[model samples]
Target: MTYIDQLGASAKQSAKVIATLSTATKNKILVAVAEELLKSEEEILTANAKDLELACSKGKKPAYVDRLALTSERIIAMAEGVREIATASDPIGIIDTGWLHPKGMEIIQKRVPLGVIGMIFESRPNVTIDAAALAIKAGNAIILRGGSDAIYSNTMLKNIFVRAGIAAGMPPASVQLVEQTERAHVRELISLNNYIDVIIPRGGKGLKSFIIEHATVPVIETGAGNCHLYVEKSADLEKAYAIILNAKTQRPATCNTIETLLLDYELLVAFLPIIAQKLADAGVVLAVDLTCMEILNKHKIIAEHATSADYKTEYQALKITIVAVGGVEDAINHINTYGSGHSEAILTEKMAASDLFAQEVDASSVYINASTRFTDGAEFGFGGEIGISTQKLHARGPMGLRALTTYKYIIRGNGQIR
Candidate 1:
């Protein structure tokens, strides 16, 4: 058999052992993994250096480089994230609901892990530990297929995570990574329906599309964040400015970063110039609509005219598009048309406006008077996230431990017939 097949088979076997592992055992193994990550900081940084150097040689954008580069602080943070996730209560075996049937039967809907997740992601090496810790904590095995750009970083991180788990009495194949950084390996892994229970793609639109189209296994779509933030006329401009700036420039390369800004026309003439100045100071390029350009020009603020393409782009960098919208309704319509159904926010004090925007916008996560960046799983108190699922199938929004599971019904009866 081929290596991919072997990996799948081994993971399938290991998932069974993991699903039955006690919560205490899983937590112990995860804590060990966290400790191992901390211990291997130098080794991981060394390996990550290779990827970072390669990225620089290739002339990747600064934001892209940030995603690839690992600092001592980032390593410490990744370890902390792992430990925090380990502390989360186990998601498995929890009864969703229990009831008595009409025929003297007891019924239970219990949560269980989906065996062997096949995860495809890019750039961020921190996802390596995050994915492994989350998968194991939720009692599922995983097959990670990271981008070729991050191959060196991913390999070393995986080694630390998997070995620690196995040493701590976890399943043999609790976590595995595709060492080969080829598209062919991804193709093969996605088709292994018998082994991988669910496939989650966390990258660009093209990568997610490729996996979605080719995968025979069930797919959970994520990323491609053409996220948006709207400023209502009644918004507190100070609060709005802070939220927009933080959402756009805090970590501009992230999926939760705002790529589009919609403003109530009244706010457009006043708040847009102030917002644009801050973004410009941060070296952000503004692609503005005619109405926005007119107001910006009035305020002597320079901006490029927005192209149609800019509206739909997930500018995973220090760039954002600006548009003057009629009101909350106009903003909602625009978002539904161009948004990636990831995260969207409305900065407004009016409860009516916030509620309307939240209700009408078709996104996995919606916010009022806050940054779209808070859509993150950790921010939502999920510990760590698999991804912000953009699809409306088995899961949506921040995929925490519960999202990694499927439910099974157990009916207790004395040899009950159908």
Candidate 2:
């Protein structure tokens, strides 16, 4: 058999064990994986150093390097993420409902793992451990395919996590990272629908698109966070300042960071002077629309008229597009047209306005007087996440253990056949 075939067969076998594992046993295994990540931090860092060196040699962008690098603190967080999952309630066998049929059959639908999940991610080594730990907790086997840029780090993490899970009595093949990093590997991996129940890609638009377009197996489209934050005419200015600043600058490199700011025309003058200075001080480039340019006409803030394309782009940097909307309803229409459906927020204190925004925004998560950053799985108390999903089918928002499983119907019949 070919290499992927062997791995697929092993994962398929391991899925049987994963599906039947007791919650307590699964928790112990997940905890063990966390401990292993902590114990192997030094080794993981050593492996990561190799990747960083290569990335630097290739002159990768600062943001790219930041995502690829690992620190002692980051490692602890990765391990803690696993422990958090261990603490969550097991979702397996929770009956959706039970019904009796006219033909004397009783049927119940219950949660179960989605068999084998194939994760194709970019250069975030931490995902290596996070994905595996979550798979164990959710009772699903995982096949990992990380980018070539993070080969060393992913390889090291996969080894540590899988070894720990195996030692804790989990199936040996429960977590498998692709041994090769060639582009061809991903092409092969995503085509294996018979073995891979789902293909989840976690990265930029390019990576997410590649998998969604090419994968023969089921694919989950994750967050591309062209997220927006709107300031209604009646918004609390102080609250808007805090929420907008946090959402845009707290971590601009993250998928949840706000990329566009929709302002009510009535609030434009009042918000421009303050929000402009804050964003400029934070080194953010304001890609303004015509109305905003006129509003900030004399404010010597770092500003430029926003290009039409800026509204649709996911600027993974300290930059934002500012556009003026006629009102709250117009704001909703603008967002629904341009938003990526990842996360959106409104910094309004008006209960009516907040209700309108929350109800009308077409996003995975909508917020009132809050930052879009809370769209994260960990922030939502899901321990960690496979990724923030943007699609409607299956799951949306931050995907935790519960999102990793599908349901099965168990029917008990008394010799009845139609």
Candidate 3:
């Protein structure tokens, strides 16, 4: 059998053993893994440095390098995140609903593992630890296939998880990383429907589209974010400025960061100059619609003219598109037309405006008077997330432990016949 085939078979076999583990046993293993991550800080950083060097050699963008780099503080945060997952209530085997049938039969629904999850992600090596920790805690096995850009960092992190888990008496192969970075391996991995129960692709639009189109295995889509922030006329300018600045500049490399800004036309002359200068001061490149461009020009600010493509793009950098809309309805229409259905927010003090925007915007997470960056699993108190699923089927927003689980029915009968 080929390498990916072997990985699938081993992961499937390991899934059986992991699925039967008690909550206490799983928690023990997770805590041990977290401790190991902290203990192996030097090794992890060393591996990350290698990947960073290669990335720089290729002349990768600063945002791309930032995603691939790791530091002592980030290592600590990863370990702490794992420990938090261990402390969460296990979703496996929890009864969802129980009832008695008309024929004196007892019926119940209980949560269970998805079994042998396949994660194909890019850049961030920390996904290695977060995905494995959540899968293990939910009593599922995971097979990780990270991008080539982070191969060294991911491999090192996987080794740490394997060592800690085995020493803690967890089943071997419970967490497997595909070291092969060949693009063909992705197609082969996704085709193993018999072994991989489901595939979760975390990357750009191209990666997500490729997996959805090619993978025969079931998928829980985590969308590419083209998030937006809308500022209504009634918004508090002070709060709006803070929210926009933080959302766009705090961490532009993340999926939740705002890529487009929709402003109420009534507030264009008043609020646009203040916010535009703030963004420009932070080295943000502005792509503006005609109305916004005119206003910025009058204020002596330089901005590029926004095109139809700019509104649809997920820049994932220090850039934002600004558009002036007639009102909330116009803003909602623009967002739904161009958004990836990820995260969206509105800055408004009027109850009616915020309510309308929240109810009408087509996104997983909608915010009012808050930064779009708050759309994170840990911030929502799930410790950490596998990914923020933008799909409507199995999951919607920030996916925590429960998102990794499925449910089964149990029926007990005493010779009841039709």
Best by TM-score: 3
Q: Which should have the higher lDDT, number 1 or number 2?
A: 1
The TM-scores, one per candidate, come to: 0.98, 0.97, 0.99
Residue 132, candidate 3: Cα error in Å is 0.4
Provide the lowest-lDDT 10-residue window in model 1. 266-275
1-418, model 3: which lDDT tens digit per residue? Answer: 9999999999999999999999999989999999999999999999999999999999999999998889999999999999999999899999999999999999999999999999999999999999999999999999999999999999999999999999997899999999989999999999998899999999988898999999999988895889999999999898888899999999999999999999999999989988999999999999999999899999999999999999999999999999999999999999999999999999988999988998999999999988989888899998789999999999989999999999999999999998
What TM-score does candidate 3 get on C-alpha atoms?
0.99
After superposing candidate 3 on the true structure, give the runs of residues whose Cα lies further than 4 Å from its correct spot: none
> Global lDDT of each model?
0.91, 0.89, 0.94
lDDT of 1 at 26: 91
Clashing pairs in 3: none
Better of 1 and 3 by lDDT: 3
TM-score-based ranking = 3, 1, 2
Judged by lDDT, which candidate is best?
A: 3
Candidate 2 lDDT tens digits, 347-398: 7778998888889889999988889889888889888899999999999999
